[model samples]
Target: MHDDRHAPRKGAIPTHALKAAQEIVVLKWRRTSFKRLDGSIDVLDDDWSLSIGGRSLARIYLLNGGPQDGRWAWFVQVFPEGTPGNGGVGVDDDGRAAREACESLLPPAIQQALADGRKSETN
Candidate 1:
């Protein structure tokens, strides 16, 4: 992951410090494909804050899954408000894979928070 601790990375929006968020929402689920994938795990959590990291990562309402490479798959749209690449759909065999993939695309600071092993109330 790119380190931009001193400088704010473009499209990288920081949330209201995980320590301060209240009333956060957490969602987790999985989807299976009879065609190709066995299943995929997904986890999404976000605070009431409208900020990038504060909002839920899974945009299931906007998800549109289909075959991407001869294999049937579902895509969970994440970080809709972030820069084009900073946040986008994460494709995986299951929800967890998809969630981790999307989480990997988060801003550097958020990623660091995750690395630091901080637990939010939502978690």
Candidate 2:
């Protein structure tokens, strides 16, 4: 019998790479909170992850922000999970406008992480 421990769990993104991709992947929301330890307490948001074939590609969150015209909510810190990249792709207005932004962002982010991992393996 095959073990199911390695199988992806709900709201959990596999940080480890998988053998192959099987279907249309998406980002799943996870509980998020922000605390201050000398930093701003206003930083808070809901977190989400994009996983493919049980492997995490990127992580994003809707950040708390002030009103600016018709915008307020911001999706910032688009970074690869597990290793290498520790910064964001860029900040964008959350909700409808941000959807396509992430769609375009995921592929390249995952590819870069995978490449970085491979490079590290050779060193």
Report how far residue 109 has shifted in candidate 1, in Å. Answer: 0.7
Which ranges in model 1 have alpha carbons more than 4 Å from their true place? 1-54, 57-86, 118-123
Cα distance off (Å), candidate 2, residue 56: 2.4
Encode model 1's per-residue lDDT on 18-80: one tens digit a residue: 332233333223222123365663433321111334344333222344554332123323343
**lDDT at 61, model 2:** 60
Instruction: Give per-residue CA lDDT, model 2, range 7-117, as digits (tens).
Output: 555444344343222221432433344457877554344565545554444455666555533332323232433232433454556554544455454445454444554
TM-score between model 2 and native:
0.35
TM-score for predicted model 1 compared with the true structure: 0.35
Candidate 2, residue 31: Cα displacement in angstroms equals: 6.1
Off by over 4 Å in 2: 1-19, 22-45, 65-88, 108-123
